[model samples]
Target: MEELMRQQQLSNGQKSERQELTCSVLFTNPKFRADKSSTKDEINSIARMVSNAEDLELDRVFRKVSKNDVEETRSLNRSLFEFGHNFEDADGWLKLEQPCKDQLATVLRYMFESHLKTTVQIEINNMYFNCHFIVLQVYSRFFSELDMIPLLVTLPENAVSQKAFMLSYKWMLSDEPVLELAHLVEVYVAATYLRITSLEAHCWKYFDDEECYNEDTACALYVESKDNPAMDVVRNLMLTRIRKFLLTFVATKEFLDLPTSHLIYLLDSDEICVNTEIELFDGWVTIGTRGKRTFGV
Candidate 1:
């Protein structure tokens, strides 16, 4: 009984040590990923070597692989390889920012107007944008399946608003980029629905920091975000600002001019930091005195 307990304690200590140790693995080979190279056999050999390593438990070897038929798809395929090691952190990566203005603008313009042999159709609210699959796939994973269907047509009927879609499409091709503050929420909703992550991030950053916050913008965002779940992040940001500065927010012309629904929405929020309910009631009367009876609150 004493021996068994001692063995059990030893095993538990080993597990505790293992849990504290971080593990990471990376594999990079310049020639192995070449088209003519035997990558499959190479990966198998590497897996066996890793599994047999003294420091690596055979059961802990993780096998992850991805392959695409380059001959059929005309796209380079690759796999993920692993070897056991503990790595809490590491830093050796370069950040490159290359801005191509004229080159991209010229190509986009040509692609928009040119009669390309291979093209994909993107339809939004009865408006059609016929574009090169190559260019489209670069910016959107949503169009990556074009390798199989060269002439596929995709519609953003329920996903994107018409105005938002048009605006995003135009902004992508514009030589001088322009996205209005008023259309930020709409564009963000459309971008999120389409899974355009970069555009989604850009729109969110704009709303979170770029634009000046006011009652009208907040109310407009509230109205536009009614049925959309993706807009919740930006909506909450606006609500937080409005709540934190309720007194100053109410003093603005935009607040008094708010529609009934928006006012009610603000009043309904428990998070609003008002001194008393009576203060809000007094403001409501002031709005009423301005003859904006449409403001129900």
Candidate 2:
């Protein structure tokens, strides 16, 4: 009986060890599997987000690079055409300095005066100009359409004066062109007729200066440009100036010399101010009397 009891106790201990092993496997297996699956899903989500962000960043970089490349190409093309004296650097590349650039422009102007490689003859107001087709094409849209080589281009009579054309030509060749106030009006008119938009815009900027105009100049400019639709901006600016000094202007020789229509136009503006109605009426009568005297009416 003691032997039987020992065998039974040994069998009971084996059963308890097997039960503990089964319980540990059942509890740990499910938790480990769940943890691995959840970790893998989270890693995949983060990786996808990181990839999208990288794509966006790369796209932005590419667009910026493309824009810079286009701008650099345009700048290079302009530099190729611009007059510059090139000196080889230590690295065997060419570079330019301000003095060298000025010297180059001077040389080119001398060549132009010497009539070297002149491809076209431009006639304006009985004056003739020997010009390079390429140079004219660069400055004027009107010249660009004339594809024929060794041509003679004649401008309409009274379209632009000889002095104005010369000034415009100088402006085209110059690296830095100054529009003197004395010659500004004629040059602006010449640029308009030539279809040189850049020079036209440059001349317009001078009118913004208050010192560029006064009662006399304003009246002259108004009469000079009133008929030109392209010069309407300058015409209107002069009109505004005239109105602002209307009382003082009417006493000036310019107002008395104004055409009958221009005098009426100024007197008709609502913006015109006077100290009294009688003063305004008196100014009008004075202009009318001058007009009648001039015309012997």
Candidate 3:
């Protein structure tokens, strides 16, 4: 009986030493201290290797005891089970599952949704937004200037519409924000006003895609882009599309609804295609008459 107790005690001592060694290796290992730039796959791979190493160590310990020593084997088995349970509860490995951006986005999203630590309120077209100044300053140069942010700030109704402001707010809180095609132009305008260059760049990428433009959007896009000197690229792209599909665009109500300046701009494009000179002249006359009646000119 004394021999059995001695063996059990030895087993207990070994379990304690093994746990300490595991912890030391886990905490002290350079690979375990995940770098900020490490991908999720890399971090998870490291975690799996560490877990496998721990299992091997436990198995090696179990093999040291004789099969006939039932009590000692049982004690070691119980220790291993308890260790695993405690380790799982610690959740150290589980934390590595999310990449840094995802983890940050999760926390930021929670904070934004909960309205936690909000330092400023922005009003747009009677809609109010509670925002964190720290977060805004990070993404927006307009907000970064100390004098620009105030307790209750109101945006100019002419510059940013309520829906556009709401979408921009969503962009600020998300790692990967989605912009709706319907509001793409408005959101781009808001992003520009806010001086959120990253958001502006993202919007430009959408504009640069030929697939994003079509007959329904092309006329309105041209009207919106024509006056803005900063939107020269977008205006040129619309011109290119109109030139390529002149007859199709001329048939749309949106084309007839174009302002006189915009109609003239389209007429002035030397690259515009038509089946014949007379066909182009008739289309221009129809568009010109519609512009005159609409503008009451």
Candidate 4:
């Protein structure tokens, strides 16, 4: 009877150990078996609307958004996509689609028509933007930090133009005008700097090699993004295209305007299309002389 009891005790211990192992396995990789709930998927889908790279880059350039703010922003955007025209669900949670758009349009119309009811003055590179604080604040976290009355803010060097800012505002209010190709670069830089995730993503499609291949345009974009470490990827992409079109690039105003160091760096590239040292020297002289004449030096 003692021997039988000992075997039963050993079996019970093994059974407990097996139970522990099973529990550990179940909890080890929760994501692999996470609940297949629609709520979780809904939040995740909006979270992925803006890519990690773009979000991180925006935060690096602009100030970082709080975790709560980030979640709220994503939720708000999801609401817009899921339900247009500012409709609310049974839970009474509001989506800000048409309401914000209508508000913005009214405010802009008022401001432009010289009504001057509730406008804030924002300064960017000697240009003044008299706009409704609420409207501007609604779309950009950068604007939200302003201390209210007639707020003045200055953007960094080579930031957005007045047109780009207005266009971005329009896009935020209503997805209209459809992201004009002519204003893409300025709008992209502005959206990124202002941490406007939607506008940034919208403008991103214009940066692909096929659309941005022109030598002057590519070189100009390359120079503009070179200063910001967050924009290194964009700068490198432009550089690649510039090298691809080296022959045409050498004669362009953009190439002429490059600092001597950059010009020398380009001259060193084996991929440059010049057939001989003489041709290379001629190209160099042409760029330098054109730069001098253009600048009236």
User: How much does each candidate deviate from the true structure in C-alpha RMSD?
Assistant: 30.5, 22.2, 24.1, 30.1
lDDT for each residue of candidate 4 in 1-297, tens digit (9 for 90 to 100): 999999999999999999999898754544543565444454454456555634543323333356677632222223454555543333535553445355786767656445377467767778776666776677677787756545566676467678878777677656454888777767887887887776777666677745654466777677676665556566666665665567776666666566554555566656455666467556766757755634321
Q: Least lDDT summed over 10 consecutive residues: which range in candidate 1?
A: 70-79
Off by over 4 Å in 1: 1-109, 112-118, 145-147, 174-176, 243-273, 277-297
Please give, for residues 122-232, the per-residue lDDT of candidate 3 as tens digits.
998778888888878898888887675589878986667888888888888777788887888788788878899999999988787767775446656876777765566
Ranking by TM-score: 3, 2, 1, 4
Expressed as tens digits, the lDDT of each residue in 1-297 for candidate 2 is 999999999999999999999898754544445535653353444446475544333322332124446522111123532556354324534453435355786887788767798888888766789887778789888887765655888886455777788788888887888977777878887888889999988997877765777555676677678776667778777876665567666676655666555555565666566666466656666666756745421
Give per-candidate clash totals. Answer: 0, 0, 0, 0
User: For model 2, what is the error of residue 128's alpha carbon versus the real structure, in angstroms, after optimal superposition?
Assistant: 1.4
- TM-score of structure candidate 4: 0.43
TM-score per candidate, chains pooled: 0.46, 0.54, 0.54, 0.43
Model 2 residue runs over 4 Å out of place are 1-114, 214-216, 223-230, 257-273, 276-282, 286-297
lDDT of each: 0.63, 0.70, 0.72, 0.64
Among all candidates shown, the one with the greatest TM-score = 3
Tell how far residue 98 is off in model 4, in angstroms.
Answer: 23
lDDT of 2: 0.70
